[model samples]
Target: MATKRLMKEYNSIQKALSDTQEYENIVSLEPTGDLFSWCGVIRGPSNSPFQAGTWKIKIEVPQNYPIAPPKMKFVNKLCHPNVNFQTGEICLDILQNQWTPAWTLLTTMSAILLLLQDPEPTSPLNIDISNLLKSGDIKAYNGLIRFYTHKYAIDSV
Candidate 1:
């Protein structure tokens, strides 16, 4: 049986998708059985080492979604402080215990976009990358990101 919370979440997600202006390279939702999942394609921000690159991500909602936050990860290789190298798991506060009942799919997506724009090194999934980003070595950071962007993001195309 579908709970009221689940129904509301489903409806909200559907409405957001229909209402939002679709970006050429951005996140989108796909239906799977009775559940729904999101597939996100983010264009690297300008001036960032990942610029001109595209990265794919996946957001998997649990059966008890809403009550528990959805899981998100990059489908393609991503070298970021908050993203896991092997599993693609993202380390975002919203997806963890900090999740609130008022948060919606749109809010979560917006947070992700913001994270790409300005990553938080304090709480990161990639320790080395996080340390580098915190060290304020912009050149090295850009170099490493560019290297991965080329090796994993661009070369795949």
Candidate 2:
């Protein structure tokens, strides 16, 4: 049942990608060698520090997916308050305690996109980065963000 549901979702995502030109370049979601594992790329939004960057993410669909949220992490390094610098762990509520069966991979990615725009500094995974952001050191924070975005996030993959 889990594989079946994932296949369905995968098909739907592929269809959506094909149908929607806007999302075509911004993101790419594809299954990995294993059906339960998937990979994706999210282009940095314009007018942000991450502009010109492309972020890669990995998604693992649990055996009991839909009943539980998928596990997702950035495959590349990013200097963000909600993202762990070392492990790429994401501190999003929906991906953790607040997850619901109604949330799908698409929704999760949408949430991640939103996170890029508005970070939750109080609940941070990278303390130093969070501090920089909270302390109003916009110059330093954006510098770090741009550096890492150029180094790790901008990839052909």
By TM-score, the best candidate is 2
Task: State how far residue 38 of model 2 sits from its true place (Å).
Answer: 0.6
Q: Number of clashing residue pairs in every model?
A: 0, 0
Candidate 1 regions exceeding 4 Å error are 1-27, 155-157
lDDT of 1: 0.74
lDDT of 1 at 39: 63
lDDT of 1 by residue, 92-127 (tens): 888898998677666776677678768999888888
Model 2 per-residue lDDT tens digits across residues 60-134: 998988888999999878888999999989999999999998887876887898898799999999999899999
